[model samples]
Target: MPSNDIAPAINETQPSFNLDDYKIIVEGSTSILTPKSEADVFYNPVQQFNRDLSVTCIKAWANLYLNPKQEGKEDIEEPELKKIKIEEKEYIKKFTILEALSATGLRAIRYSKEIPNISKIVANDLLPAAVDTIKRNIEYNKASTNVIPNLANCNAVMYTKEFDCIDLDPYGTVAPFIDAAIQSIKNGGLLLVTCTDLQVLAGQTYPEKCFALYGGSNLMGHDATHESALRLVLGLIKTTAAKYGKYVEPLLSLSIDFYVRVFVRVHNKPIKVKDNMSEQMIGYMCHDCDSIVNQYLGKREERTSKKGKPYIKYGLSKAPTSSTECKVCKSGVQHLVGPMYGGAIHNKDFIKEVLRINKEEHEDNIYKTRKRIEGMLTLAYNELPDTPFYFSPSKLSSILKISVPSLKYIVAGLGSLGYECSLSHAQPSVLKTNADWNTIWYVMKEYVRMKEPNYKVEKLNENATGYRIMTNEDIKLNDSTKSISFEPNDMSYKIEKLRKLKMVRYQENPTRNWGPKAKPN
Candidate 1:
């Protein structure tokens, strides 16, 4: 039996009830419900006869509003809920979410049911049946009192009252709804959009089809079909939002197995093109060797370097070029990769606020909520760095000796706090210079302070060969045994163990053989 399957139980109070009496069909499967009124039975042949389709749709809504994931699985697990709580805590009191293509009331029902104190939710669907279903779902879930469902086509913008968040999860491509969705979101509002038409976006088919769906031309000789899809969607969304005098910065974008999801923040103030737009960077990947490089262009740099310039004279800085030759490619790079959405996932202050709200409103099990939030927030803070950037957690873990999940939470937390962050493929420890080391050290220091204030930090010597701890009065040497040649008992065995883990490295002349020493057998 599948994990989600449940055995039917007899109800003595309802003698006429039979599990097979009424078939509730949704997208793909037929579910038998115990005898119920016709109104209670929901059957939609378009949904492929699956009763759980409605439930899955509701789960997607909840995930986006409260606990969104890069992947499109349809279950609202505990991990996802924790993420939602963390988001709610930071962006409280003033946030609004617009369900641009809300079909049936699944998404609205979940939002109203789960998220506490969500100021307002505008749920709109084009079909009358979908609108009725949305209303009915709200009422059935007892969310009607809190949620307001609307009946409209994709022209939801006509009813827009300037929402802080706009979610576009259409049946296929979100292209038709883009213009309206962008116009409706308030300045600084968040937009959550999903695209299910993978074939068009992935560039496996026609260029016109891709353009019609994603609003961007497909590039040749690139395996970035998924990335291209995201960029195309983002470019289209940005263009649409610009028409309304709103500039959108894609804060988070992920291409999951089945679809692509993007979350962008609207900026309505004086464009601040120099500052915000200047930070936008792109990463180019080598088609041959898989080596990647990140390039950042300032607004001024873009303006000054409009036309190619010859070699510069002494004392004058040459204008930076938009395109650079990939060291790995050895051939001229063909693609302009991304201003890929990068940002923190969990904000600390926001999470604290959420906890306060939950405590004030609900008297139920807030402990679990708090714990989950804390864990997620901690992970985000410790692992993730500022965005409009990139950093690979896997590489960071290799250097730091920490798990990828631990780093993910930290990165997510930092992202949620409004910090720009990215994951680089480069190893954190092997960063090119001392400046990089200092930044890492500073980040680690701050993280330690937040996570464990009592933790001690020891600095390595200038030679990078050994380090001494003031707290423990221990001295570690740079030999293979990682021998501690100090007063009292020498813990050479323990020192070597730490060295073998590469947690510590030795500084030497000519070549720096920095790494933990081998442990004694």
Candidate 2:
């Protein structure tokens, strides 16, 4: 395919195929040559937010390590090995990126035009048409110098070369490419992954298939199954990297609309791989009660020897088995949902840094979804202190047949009880907190029993999961309850602060029938 092989001018034979080319300006910098239709090559307008976020994240990542200052560091010499000292602030100028599945080369071109420190980007695709479209798009955008369009398989190309950054945004599960991606990245590289197979990861239809691909069980019963999906993918990456004496440190992991995206920093450290054991855990979830207990498959404890050397003891050699019955519900058997990455999904400093860049460097209008980014990042930052799994107040209300409480009330009430609480960025109605299911239920029950005296309690014991663990302990409502109040652990004034920044809570459909897009026709 020639660099100028753009679709022929609108004609009877060509039928346009929605091939009308247009320019899209993002972040006040990159101007992408994009097509209107997907009949020839793939392009999703809705995922502009994903692409926009990626640009900022990559820039921040590069600025931190690539363009860093040396402070009192001495070069060490190894007797058995040759020591190579990185020159001060020289290698940081030219960074290489690999976009494994560059359908139309939009992302690659944008990186070239937008990211100042980027030197080269290899945009690859297996489809001949996609390869041709990428080349033409690159030519149209005049990004030929930086983005090299390739006609090759993503995995094959990834396995052959190493890069400072590798992006895997496949149409479905990234399982097949994960190993190759792990091999493709250098010792201290960034890997951004996107998985669109939400049905397999979050849906309950195919447990066996999910296990086969992710080497972990899916939590069909858990309301936050989307989060489990992210963790499952991370677990796969960590396990694959560990096989090569490498480990993954997730900087940011999120469940955006219809898919999951994660940014991870990979490092080569066999000794630190033991940290993954504590980071990986199996979730014991009760189908009846929605109670979740995380049991680590691997355990690590620090010990001191007689010579005063500190060492870690690992106790996880085998896979964990499922429990016969739920610890909370007792009647229902607990479903084993993991062997997934149970570590912190997002790095606070990293996300904060991204937020800072998004605000300080980029303009407000061109980025478009900047406010929502702030809201979401705020929620993510606040939830950092809470546990992994969060309970949905609306789901709990439905189970108990009570009026759904406002998100503010639930959070404030939890805080009053000395428990931390925050809204989940994944789902607006969901609440992430350190309170156990019992305490949550007790609080809700007390609120309901006080407000609606007519509602019967005798019937709840049989149908409501809350009743199974609900105690008669009286929760003294403080004077703060008299007025409608709102407070988040992140110390934000109220949920309104986030909700007021509308359009950030959830993205509006950019077009009709928008979702996991179809392959190029």
Worst 10 residues of 2 by lDDT: 1-10
The TM-score of candidate 2 is 0.84
State the TM-score for model 1: 0.47
Once fitted onto the true fold, the runs of candidate 1 whose alpha carbons sit more than 4 angstroms away are 1-97, 118-120, 157-160, 200-236, 249-257, 273-285, 292-326, 338-521
In candidate 1, what residue range of length 10 has the lowest lDDT sum? 1-10
Expressed as tens digits, the lDDT of each residue in 358-398 for candidate 1 is 34543323222333222222332232333322334344333
Highest lDDT model number = 2
Query: Distance from true position, residue 360, model 2, in Å?
Result: 1.4
Task: Give each model's whole-structure lDDT.
Answer: 0.43, 0.73
Q: What is the TM-score of each candidate against the true structure?
A: 0.47, 0.84
Q: Write one digit per residue (lDDT tens) for candidate 2, span 1-521.
A: 01112112211232222435654433334554454443544667678788888888898786665554454331211122212335763333466788999887888887887788665788888988787677766665667776888888877777777777899999889999999889878767789999999889989898888999999987896788988998899999999999988989888888889898999988878888878878888887888767777778778789999999998887864554446765444546677788898878888877887889888987766676677677677777666442787788888787667888777667776665666766677887887777766567656766676656777767676645655544334323344444322344442345546556544666667688988778555
